[model samples]
Target: MNPETAKPATAAEHFFDRELSWLEFNDRVLQEALDARTPLVERLKFVAIFSSNLDEFFMVRISGLIERERAGAAGSAPAGMAPSQQLDAIRTHLARQTALQHRLFDGELRELMKQHGILLLDYAALDEPQRGALEAHFSGQVFPVLTPLSVDAGHPFPQMSNLSLNLAVIVEDPVNGLRKFARIKVPDTLPRFVALPQGPDQAGWTGVPLEQLIAGNLARLFPGMIVRGHHMFRITRDADFTVREDEAEDLMLAIEEEVGKRHLDGFVCRLEIERSMPAELRESLMEELEVSSRDVYEFDGLLNLRDLFYFLSLPLPELKDMPWTPVVPAPFQAAPDESGEPRATLFDAIKRGDVLVHHPYHSFAATVQEFITQAAHDPQVLAIKLTLYRTSGDSPIVRALIAAAAARKQVVALIELKARFDEENNIAWANRLEDAGAHVVYGVVGLKTHTKIALVVRKEEEALRRYVHVGTGNYNPKTANLYTDLGLLSCRDDLVADVGDLFNYLTGYSRQDAYRKLLVAPLTLRRRMYELITREMEHARSGAGGHIVAKMNALVDPEMIRHLYEASRAGVRIELVVRGICCLRPGVPGLSENIRVISVVGRYLEHSRIFRFKNGGADEYYIGSADWMTRNLDHRVEAVTPVEDAAAVHHLEQVLAFLLNDNRHAWDLQSDGRYLQRQPAEGEPERAAQALLMEGARLGEF
Candidate 1:
């Protein structure tokens, strides 16, 4: 009955469908919306996130499958499903998720929010005065930006932008008595919901859907034609194009051209239309978009519920979750003397020992950003090297890099131009860094340099010591407040040497095969991971209580899953806290009986990756940016540094324990790929991981 003794099953039987697992993850997000315990506005936020996440899923994942299916390359995925099979499953699951999204929004959250005085009035429900006011607002603000394109013999079907909401009108030529189709793209510059001015009887601010307002006054746009019927529809196009870096003369230009092309010419992946659209009109739209019934979603309410984010951020504090401000870790905070200004800086603290930062709980500004800023101004700091995958528009990290370069310090910034949707932003940063006298590398030839690491070389009294900041998330200060990530500010000699070599391999042609204190992907990480798992199995077989715990965004790598299964069979207790996609079929009798997987979705995104191994009481832990996915382990540059510092190891252990013990926001993955929501046992108190972390942050305990 042991996992080691159980016969090995086929790949298909052992793994869950990847696309379906992703849909299940999104469903978990939707479950947050269905929960009445969640705050009203926060529930709305989850709905918006669900919609946004699904849109991206289709754009990249579904579109890739469609392309493969078209090219006759419908190969089986790691989970043993062909592209066609996965597509069919995705269509069914996504349809259900979409339907549930609308039901939660229109049937529940909308009414609940209205009762809280945030009125979302439909055009049909508006009074004459309110209608007139909205019409005036539309005429002045929205009318000038509107451009209506006619589709007839004289005019071709207009090129539609990806994810743009538009009104498809069936206009009748009054003189000729012929019906035609025309499109009016809702201005992306305008808000999806416009707030109307408060009237004498209006209790709270009433808002009108922007599309509804435009639909009500359609006659004004097409002055001579009779407006027969109009319905809202949105197009989601394939935005997951890769720049042929090998064939490209300039990677930046290639990425930019691809980005622009996706706006106009990307293949349509989804066509979401209003359910009230006539059957004939819907058919015509599907034909024009070149998408069949499989890709069409007829929503009963809003087409793009992602616009609900606007209302989620409204100043309705009573209906929202309490605001959380990230606290400064005790190590990062300065210790003021009697004069109140005689404290040591972040650099001084790092010089003493390693400082571990748990973000959204610990302030990134006080640690990561401060580290870069101080390095830029310090005269002794000679050079800086960092890898930038994705960051904010007004990124303080980018600004600091520019300052460091301007100060005549040797600065190398490897900007990954293919960070999925952030190509343009990275391009802008690369240009800014180049203009500011920094050497910019557009990543490696084929792989994305995704390691979140920054190395600073300082000419100290002892020697030219290296200071490193390696993290599990982007260096962007904005996301640091929203994503739960871990970072270590260390000056450890071995760790520093590994980080320097990593930067060298990223920037130059020098490639080292192994690292001392860090496990790097595509070279040492995978082999080291196997060794770690094998060591755990050996320990368990030798009568030592073997324990393995890991937390990542996903766990889809087949080799790693197989290792975990083998370890499970060997009596090792394997615990995984994956936030998103997980293909491992845990809790399968005799196969994965020793393994347990849990997912935590809460206020802060669980973005950090942690790996722990109880190596016969010689405990080892690592934290970094690599997830247990093939792309991260074999196709991208990643770094995972050992937590040699006892305090940092304790912090990671606490985090893993909190995530595994969570009841309110955790979902357990089953052998059949279905997730069961974890609930508190009778008489057991409820515990939310994010809340516990927040409380710990307030107390400066984590």
Candidate 2:
């Protein structure tokens, strides 16, 4: 093991800490909460979103790192930091964020809400009548559902569920004079915030925390015990579990069992307790939970701020952002005839040429949903195939498949059961689809099927034709309104044939090494992407135009980052619009000076992945679900389809340009691993990509 014989440092040395970078992205969300320009209710919703995001981060990312640290695993991540060091840094940063969160909720937000008559009152702050009413409400609505467990020689501490807020009460046995710890889990069935009756002539809402009411009435639960202290706490558990797809006898059962374990048996990753909790009590709970001091957080405000969604959902219009209805792309809407009757169908629109649909701005219901609904009812349609990773709870897409199957049309569905936290929902949908007589596949072994595609085969005239929809997002209409994604509807021979082949590869054992028009992951997507990058590099070297633009949710693959670095050195002007977890360092003096990266975090999530390559002025564009992450590139079964139609290509370019030029709600990544907000310069007009898209959709401009 000579020092000289050590392996050379690779491009990974230039990568940023991915976990830290993700935390930075969450901080940007926090900035949205802190921004006064955001509607007050939306600001609160952002805070809740930030909390929920952090909880998941801890469950998956931090928990994995902690396990590695405990196992004495050696070596640094791509960011070049050891697991223990990353944990330390995470704790420091999270402490700052927690402090800021409490400051916002307890300070400015509280005063503002008070002025609007939305009082977050504590049990002690309630008047006698209000307190009495709450006591009555607790007795009727909460007490029966509560379970109190004692921690002692006779009774070991109860297993705490993940992320459930609980009250740790110290009660003294009156006769024996013995002190004991009791735990009461706040029922998830009950609302986190309980509404109270408005005062005479009152106009706004007032509420009390269910925990505060329960804590105040502990004496009623244990009539003979003397309550001494009560403190609130929550625990986050490890949720990263993978099915052994190769060994699994049933993928569905494995996923179902794993999802169950997520709630009942995950290793504790972090413990959050009230800051005022006694040191001894805190240590006791920590010891019982088997968590380290570094994993503990002391919060002064309400724990589990994700519960703030309760307040965010209030019917206070003035406190929320104005609603804008998603519009159908103008091309999809039929023009009125002389009789004032619309005649065009979604199929007719796609038949004209490839149609590009931008979601949240363009209506998903009118395009994707209509595509499936029409196919289901159309007498000419013979079969329907779709890959569903995650969809809305009440999915119209799934219903359409069920109807098509019931109608004796061949319906094949590849439902991914291991869609992270959406496993249970996906499993339910898969079961229902199976029950409805549809042929359902649980994706491929060892790899998650993440490609968003739907193929409809129809008997048109004298021939069977295929209509394909390839998208950069899931078929979930609910998310379509919250996540910015791109979808292409096309019926071209080659593209539809490729989509048909893709469905075959996903459903049956038809393995094609090369697709006609798709870049299928774990087979051709990664190789094709590398080849494209190399082509751009060659163009740059030959003094031809070498320009590249890619927009994605994340970019963390070591090889891709290195290739981009090489292309930059070869004089390629690379612009990356990454919404989260960008590891590549941009603007380095001589290393990555030609690469520029910007992230836009606005009202809608930028979830689409678009790649553009200017190969000697022959422009090429692609849109799909795969990001540049290693999982997306090398592990998952993904699909990226080329945008061949001139009009569709132009639409993609317009989107990329709008996002790149966005000064509002956009942050630029610096070489120093920091994100600086991109604001309009003096005398420059402000531009927010999402807002502009909304306006464009209103005017039917796209």
Candidate 3:
């Protein structure tokens, strides 16, 4: 059915809520754990990922919402919800999701343990011998780091740091006929799980949670004082930092100082003792944390489920999924006798002509990093230009850039300071780049240079020819191992010209000019997409094979969504593979019935952004760093270059076909914002996009 074949609607629903849409994406990720075909331990990891994702959502997005509410801002939620109304809805849904999270975590953990002959013991469940061993472990390892606080006429409430788990203790001095409140923060340095020494009554390889261990050791810390009761709690403070641009002489220095000070701030979210706790103790916690009931969560397990990641790394291979290694592209990693050693050299290959690499299938290390490394050290290479957004700790790209700069070769690196949570690392890289005599720019004020592009200019035979590498993912090789991204290596003059222009626009004098072959953000990407959509509308009206295929990390731009809706109305065949955060409602009558959307979640992250627009019979292909989010298309700097290489275009199209046809890791979008997996038909084959690619990679190696 064509996306444009929707029945007409008399009334229309507003755009989907961005926050709720994000939550749904997370839900899809969580559903992976329920998939019986996915390895049990790997399913456990999905649960880990879901919890971690939620923790970040609260720390950043929810924190922002709380701040807005406190400021009495009049902004409505992205889906037409009033600020207050959005908050209420968000909290209610979050509570439900968290409840689901609790069940999945507990169930998966129990299953893994049962299969592996390991056990987790609660305070009440611990046997005498285990209890004795735990007490000893607590005394030796945990008690020294503990700090007990008492609330009395002489002492006020104790302070807690953001996300710090503390025990709210209610003690009594029976002799003095007095009641007291005390607090002890579970030390951050201590591991959240303590393995107990097995004794005669051992429930094979049993362990206790760190919080419970501390609860048991409460008497040891406050000896001779009647240890009444203690309840576990945690606080999440406002993480937003404020730095005045005008006041700072050096922006990096200012950010560094401000980042240091952010540790101390007002409470943003809190988690308190889940079960029955004294009202007085709860009230005291509220007063100390300085937050209301909405900020608090009562949980059954631990205050920070995020810490479960530590235990999730069980190292029990049998309990885990089949481990598979990333493969280098056959063209690059093929045997010297088979594919020629020269084919492996990315720089030489690109200098000779151009090459396109699809990552995870093709090794990012051998492609993106190797290209940079060769450019930096090559005697033929005279200058290098690159963009740095996010990379690993021991990044080969950074080392190569530094080596080039130290060797007196021209190296210019644009480090985006506002990369969110990676600000400090980027600043560190910026300083290193600057110290090595490489020209480092913080990009335009308020605009993040999110484009992943690099240009290497070498004096080839007295005239300079440009070697360029552009991608849909960051230069970070670590993520490249998991994220499905596409990159191109070319000395193509037209592509070179556009990339050179883009680099100059970021680092040197800003050139307000039209890009020749690249669709750049904050200028023409959105306009070009709008025009393409219009062209598709024209083609559909002309009775041609009008179609649109787009793969992106998110689909949340209101205008872009509306345009897709219009294209649906115009009789265009639209298929979207949005890996996360899709807001456009598909399969609705008269709205987007022509539009079909699916999300693929698997071992490898679906990350590359590729779009195909059918201009009657002829199709145009584009791959880029930008998603369809408003920030990418309107606020941040991004680039999408057309894939003109016939082989490359075929490659991208095949990938799009795979994702669209996928069933095992794919979930179809319904009109009501729910993603339902397409049930496999009897005698019909299973299709997992990633698995098929991995098979292709294996065959390519042969």
Which parts of model 3 are misplaced by more than 4 Å?
Answer: 1-12, 74-78, 128-136, 152-156, 197-206, 242-247, 334-344
**Which candidate ranks first by lDDT, i.e. highest?**
2
Which residue pairs clash in candidate 2?
A: none
Candidate 3 local distance difference test against the native: 0.80
Question: How do the residues 1-702 of candidate 1 rate in per-residue lDDT, one tens digit apiece?
Answer: 856568774467888877888888889898888999999988989999998998899889999999988887755756767787878888888778788889889999889988888888889888898888888998899999999999988999899999999999999989999998899999889999999997687565579889999999999999998999999999999988877889999888988998889887889999999999999989988988899899898889878888889976577887788988888888767878999894787778888889899988888887898899989988999999988988999998889989999999999998999998898899999999999999999767889889999999999797898899999999888898889999999998899999988888888887788889999988899999999999999999999988999999999988889888888888999999999999899988877988999999888889999999999999999999999999999999999989888788888878888888999999999888889998999999999988988998898786
Per-residue lDDT tens digits of candidate 2, residues 547-626? Answer: 99999999999888888887777788999999999999898655678899999998998999999999899899999999
Top candidate (TM-score): 1
Q: TM-scores of all models?
A: 0.98, 0.97, 0.92
Candidate lDDT scores, in order, read 0.89, 0.90, 0.80
Model 3 per-residue lDDT tens digits across residues 554-587:
9988778888888888888899999889878887
> TM-score of the candidate numbered 2?
0.97
Candidate 3 lDDT score at position 374: 84
Runs off by more than 4 Å, candidate 1: 2-4, 199-203
Residue 667 of model 3, lDDT score: 90
Candidate 1 lDDT score relative to the true structure: 0.89
Off by over 4 Å in 2: 1-12, 336-341
